[model samples]
Target: MSSLGRHHDPIVAIATAPGRGAVGIVRASGKQLQPLVDALIGAPLKPRQAHYGPFRDATGQPIDHGLALFFPAPNSYTGEAVLELQAHGGPVVLQLLLARCLEAGAGIGLRLAEPGEFTERAFLNDKLDLAQAEAVADLIDASTEAAARSASRSLGGAFSAEVEQLAERIVNLRMLVEATLDFPEEEIDFLEKADARGKLAAIRAAVDAVTARARQGALLREGLRVVLAGQPNVGKSSLLNALAGAELAIVTPIAGTTRDRVSETIQIEGVPLHITDTAGLRDDAEAGDEVERIGMARSWESIHSADAIVFLHDLTRLADADYQAADARIAQRLATADPARLLQVFNKADTGVSAGSDGRLLISARTGAGLEALRQALLKRAGWQAAPEGVFIARSRHVQALKQTAEHLAGAAAHASQADQALDLFAEELRLAHLALQSITGRFSADDLLGEIFSRFCIGK
Candidate 1:
């Protein structure tokens, strides 16, 4: 839809879940909802007050007895005249109420709301900024308590406030730098006298602080994807069951017992870890049948895409030359792909097996020995320190924006530090940095970006 088209139409939707519940709500938003109120409820509604009544169809037949609420324009969620019919929480009942609303408001252009159209309207009407609009969806999808609280903080404008503050500093610095360019001959060094370099340094520091918090928030929103990969029968399934505290993956002594991926999500310190147990890697030609080959291929695929790969080494077989050769081959492939995300773990420590290298962690999945340390190691690899008291939830897009802003600031700093600095280049860098920061809060955003964001939200939100 065009920018103005969103505001021109009246929208209706079932605001509650589809299944049976205590109550269900059918909501309508438009320029004027008094007519709709009169049609559906057969009486006038007091603003912001719920009146117990019967919601009737076009024939004046009672569809459901419920509460009617009316919110006049500029005071409702969408900043428009809104009407809500709270009726019995049954699928058929809600459907009837929704249909009645469409029938009542048909002349006024009332149509079914698109996914996230309600929150999108809130954004367009200045009721909430882009960041806050996004937080509304994040708050709904939050999987952990920490994540929910963090999303709440973002919705409350904590994250946007920080971005605005950074933008203000950049604006001030740009103004100082631009002034120097406008009148080069004019006078006592404007930048030097005003301590422009000192201000730039301070802005850079602030960006770093916000970037750190944003990283933590992103971790909470998009938890680590950890893949357990190693040779066959190396206790990969056992380790998965131990971490999940459930027998999610089948365990057996037979080789190639797990021919597919077994996945589970578990939280440590309020940060989720999506763990996957995959078919073991092997070099032998006679390792498995056709199914096992496909499974191993999938295991490699998971490893390449994972945030972290736990290389489980059977400590008991460390002394065997064949096992050593196979491990060396796998290590070579990992080093070529992503060596930084790999964590060497020696399994079966309860059998008196020890790690050959100091960098590797020794753990016994059977007895749960060293499991806590393993959890901590996984968190460390994922770049999650801990869930701080006031951390906010952030998406990957937010993290990318912060990184881009930081890069621009770094460029600006470099230009500022030159002995024979170009003021124009420095000012341009600051402008770019400001724009990047603005993108986070949607001061400068594209229409397509907004569509992609709100498309993920549930309908009527």
Candidate 2:
């Protein structure tokens, strides 16, 4: 699509992870793979058959012994003739074997693969679409089991198929609407038609449903950013260490143990949560004051920006006399008339914040207590309770496209209600919406997007 560079000759690369192990695989795919195999292994290897063979040098001496499998074109990963060398995993051995391939293939025309070029070839050859191609990278980069599972589903075309199905639904309705516009007398009073309205309602519901799922998928892909914020000595650092299950943050009884944001990526029930522990917020003029001021300013910013804010307070240290001052400071910072993004987190339950702190989590971070409840609360705020069945991996780009398509669909619905002649524009918007949907699945995308998507893939994938 973008006139991306591709080798007309066969391409070869080490497919397995680069390292010394029991076995390593060198994969080759393209037209002219047979000759490379013929020279490298010194025989006419059978297609789809794993032949135990001896690899040799140009002088026809044995280099190493391994199995070679050939997958003929129109059947392999790139719809090309493929050869795989299952050889020793020593880095030096693989390099020698690769060098032999380069030498042998030079006579038969072969080249080394660029980063992500193999997967790019697969996509170009119709083996996978853009989204599935992206899922290839996602699967490789999946940090957690849940992320891996979601990426597996994506690579299996779950996410793309859903988007395609939604587009088909919208297109079907648009066709009906366009038909009504084309021949007003042919269809039974389309606007007043009960079935038409019902169909419209169904499409709307479907769109809303998919949009919600996409949002959740987006959260799963881009984990929730939860910021810990409160006054100095509020046990924010302790809370970070507790959540991270490690000393990710420097915890000290000192008021400003954390002078800057300490971030950690954690997994809770397969949901990735990014926790940012910020410096304490308060008023003071010393260096501690400057640090607290910076921390306080950052706390307010994060509170406004983060998906959820955990407002920490040292229950044992928060004196009744200081509650008014503290709450006033926090309230003033949070005074903006916006949606609620803050959650009260009273720390230092080990110090006994009084039995009256019953409604809130009561635990000692020092003792590694109350963390389960905290994780659950975070997950609840993240809307991550849904099972992975309906969940699929989605990129921010996919979310943005879906949102744009939703906006257009809403506009189309509005037009449908107001003007008889508006069906034409509605049809146009519906087309746009459909294309936007296809963009997610890569049915509709430019070459640049494909290049960008594949560029992230590791070589040999």
Candidate 3:
């Protein structure tokens, strides 16, 4: 449904998950909620106070004993008068309370809230900006402790504050440039007097720093995609089980035991890493059956799309001629993959074989050796730095906006250094940069983008 037309109508919904709980809340937000409050409780509720009472239906029959809270307009979450009913945590009980609210509020056009309508209203009412509003959902959906903390910081306006500061600086420069353009007859070199070049340089540096931190935040939220691949029976499943600390995949001495990908998400230092163990890689001619060939085909596909690959090799089979030939062929094929994202690891290190220092990792999945190093290596590959304490949760779109701002700043710098001193071009570039920053805080956002962003949120929030 469109958020433009029906935002002013009174809305009510159960504010808790759809299940039995110790207590459930039926929340309503709109202007002039006093009538609805009186109809349900038979008395006017004091603003911002909770009163113990019984909710009643239209016929004055008690629905349930609960706490009623009333918040006057401009003092509530959605910047409107609000009412909350706390009742026993039963699905049927909550439904009854909700129906009662709708029935009693029918005169004021009260209706069920759409998904994310409440938070969208909060955003529209200036109770929260776009970034902070997004953090509300991020906090709820965070998969790691560090992620939750970072999202909390964002919700508290840490990220938005920084973006606003950057925007303010850009605005100051734009004003200086435009002022110089307006009064060219005043024989004064505005660029030299105001030190516009130095200020632009400083702003560029600040934008770069924010971009770096935002990339880290994005990494924490979306994690790296790692794929483990090797010949059959090369301890791929064992490594997966070890990383997840569970027997997620069947491990045996038989080849082609896994006919599909076994995926798991494991966190190292609060950074999530999604690891997928694919079927072993081998030639179709050596396949025992069509099923194995299909699995092997899938393995190659996983390897091609992976963000990182851990190529495991059996330590004991290094001397076997047939195994070496297959390994060489796989290595040749992997030559096309990204060298920065690939790691060659030798498994079964407990067999007492001397591991050479050829930049390959040696580990035994059984003994858990070198796994910590591997984890660190993956984090390094993903360019994760700084603890989550100093980082605020950010999405890929935020990163893209920051990058666009930087590019515009670069264009501004180029225009500033020209022989003719193209102040008009410089001012235009700064204006573009300012707009890029404004999008992050919803200052210049499109209505469709707002709809899309809020659509992902759960109902009643």
User: Which is the leading candidate under TM-score?
Assistant: 1
Candidate 2 residues 1-461, lDDT tens each?
Answer: 23265546678889889878999988888887767777877778777889997988899987789999988887888778888999989988888888899998887678887778777877778899888888888878777788888888888988888888888888888888788888877745665673555666677677777777777666767789899877777778888887787888877778777777888999887778888998777665533656567765666677777877887766676566776587567767765624356677777777755748359766567776777888888888877766547677778898899888888887777777865667788788788888888888777888788777776777787
Score candidate 2 by TM-score against the native.
0.88
Stretches of candidate 1 exceeding 4 Å from the true structure: 1-5, 354-359, 419-421
Error of 3 at 403 (Å): 0.7
**TM-score to native of every candidate shown:** 0.96, 0.88, 0.95
RMSD of 1: 1.7
Model 1 lDDT-worst window of ten: 1-10
Instruction: Name the candidate, 2 or 3, with the larger TM-score value.
Output: 3
Residue 158, model 3: Cα distance from true site in angstroms: 0.5
Candidate scoring better on TM-score of 1 and 3? 1
Q: Residue 443 deviation, candidate 3, in Å?
A: 0.9
Per-model root-mean-square deviation over C-alphas = 1.7, 3.2, 1.8
* Ordered list by lDDT, greatest first: 3, 1, 2
| Residue 61 CA displacement from its true place in model 2, Å | 3.6
- What residue runs in model 2 are displaced by over 4 Å at the alpha carbon? 1-3, 7-9, 107-109, 184-188, 259-261, 282-284, 288-305, 320-339, 355-363
lDDT of 1 by residue, 312-408 (tens): 9998998999999999988888886677799989899999755656676889999999899999999999888767787888888888898898898
Model 3 ranges with Cα > 4 A deviation? 288-294, 297-301
